[model samples]
Target: MSTQINTIPASEAVRSAEERIASYDWQEFATELSGYGCAVLPKILTPEECKEIAALYPHEEHFRSHIHMARHGFGKGEYRYFKYPLPDLIGGLRTALYPHLADVANEWNARMGIDQRYPAEHKDFLKQCHDAGQTRPTPLLLQYVPGDFNCLHQDLYGDLAFPLQIAFLLSEPGEDFTGGEFVLTEQRPRMQSRAEVVPLRQGDAVAFAVHNRPVQGTKGNYRVNLRHGVSRVRSGQRHTVGIIFHDAK
Candidate 1:
């Protein structure tokens, strides 16, 4: 009698991830982003994977620097920027998500009267950032305890901003945290700032404007300034992984 083994090929795993990203209704996502300046994506990571990524937080070697938000007036929580040679899952996600986001970035840039256009691949964009003296990686993992929060701010690293960024909730909303809602504020010209509360779940991700986006106006297209933050966490702890395409200065 012969024994049998069952296993998935590495190529199959990559193909599945690629297909999952490609199969998303990006048209709908684009519309949502164009209308609201942010879009929430379906579950891209499994619950187990979310837990696994969150577990990496305690390991200091993986991170180059750990930031205390309160010390920097950023908020009450803390976050760590990953060092070079990111984890395989993170690097893969960064690469796989870039092309689709680059399309949207280019469209927004054109509409906003900006001349900069992103490259088709993430590595090419990183190279451009490096050539401009931005060598630090910007991808980070953020942790928040009860009463911890983040300030409404932009993730502008240098002159070559990608204009788009994504954050994934690694913990369950109500179970892991209560009042830590994702908040975004838009400053339209000649008007009061408007706040938007985005709802998310574990393994869910949101793509949002890093600084600003273009909105159609009577004359043509106008730029609206935007910022994002986390509301105070009422109870429990929260963890999120931020995927930023640009390198930092």
Candidate 2:
């Protein structure tokens, strides 16, 4: 007797991710990021895909490190950072999304008068981070329950940082969870901090600045500091996957 095994090809997964990413209006996304410091890509992943990724959260072999947010003053939930060999879907999305974001990152640096620029390809950029002693992967899965929340923070892991990062909501809003809104805050120079509550449904992704972004002023472009977090969950469970391009030290 012969046994049958069902598995999807890695290349096929990557190609699918690339095709989905290519379907979005990236120019509009870039414009939105330039203006609001964040943009949403609706239904970037299918509901089934989101569930599959979220289900990986409980498997220890898929992660390198597990973090209890409260223990580290991060928040009330927990998360795990994926190891070197990220899951195919996560890896594929990371690779496919970087080039488009790289263009925007370069433009933001130029506007902010920063000398740093990212490479056109994700692998080349990862090499830069690895050479700088940031060899650990930063992609992670986060889980939250009722009364749990994430503190406002930047995902900077080293001196080499990607300006933008993306997070995908894996669970439905009204069905699987409630009151866990994605939030971003911007600190403008000598002025008040502005808060934005970004609404997201299952399979939706939001890309935003990791630390600083250029905001146009009367004279020239000025820099505004940005941080992101999740608001308190009121009921049920919430799962999310974050794609941070830069590795950690």
Candidate 3:
């Protein structure tokens, strides 16, 4: 007997992604980002959609490069960066999510006293990255089995860095994985580092700062540095898809 796999058409996938993205209360998302440096966009993808994306992990044709975290001292497990002409669902999410993120990113840059601003569209921003010779795609699929974890680190790839990115949990927390939690750390000037463990369910996406974000201080807005990673997986398997707006050099 043979099992059949279901897939969404490119047009339908893009439409679904756009419609779901449009339904969110972005003002609340922006507020959350301003206060915490991260915000959850719950159930942005359906469980079946999550499974479809995760199922692409072992296919070599879909990716540009593969990375083993341990070889780079980036902790354990492995990941693969997608090539240009990204899979429709991933590409759709990337295109649909950027404008909203750009608004928040531009505001953060202003508050942090950084002069950089992102373009209003994802394609225009990619053009900037490409013109600067950072042409490699940044979106990736990560897989971790038991005993794997990631180190806290920023996702900056080139001289031009987008302030925010998103990661979707493609596996169910309790059933498909265990003990591997999404973690973010913030370091404020002249103070201790603060850690936050974000709880996520299957198909949920978390948007977060890629490097620096502004925090309101008694005097004025001050910049805080942030790094994100994952805790060790105690049992089962886990998968995630990351959407980074800027390309790599």
Best by TM-score: 2
Put down candidate 2 lDDT per residue, 116-195, tens digits, no spaces: 99999999999999999999999999999999999999998999999999999999999999999999999999999999
Q: Against the true structure, candidate 2 has what lDDT?
A: 0.93
Give RMSD to native, each candidate: 4.6, 2.8, 1.9
lDDT of 3: 0.93
What TM-score, over all chains together, does every model reach?
0.94, 0.97, 0.96
lDDT of 3 at 108: 90
- Looking at model 1, report the run of 10 residues with the lowest lDDT sum: 1-10
Positional deviation of residue 51's Cα in model 1 after best superposition, in angstroms: 0.2
**TM-score ranking from best to worst?**
2, 3, 1
Off by over 4 Å in 2: 1-6
Candidate 1, lDDT over the whole model: 0.89
Separately for all candidates shown, the number of backbone clashes (residues 3 or more apart, or on different chains) is 0, 0, 0
Candidate 1 per-residue lDDT over residues 75-134, each given as its tens digit: 999999999877667777888899999999999999988889999988899999999999
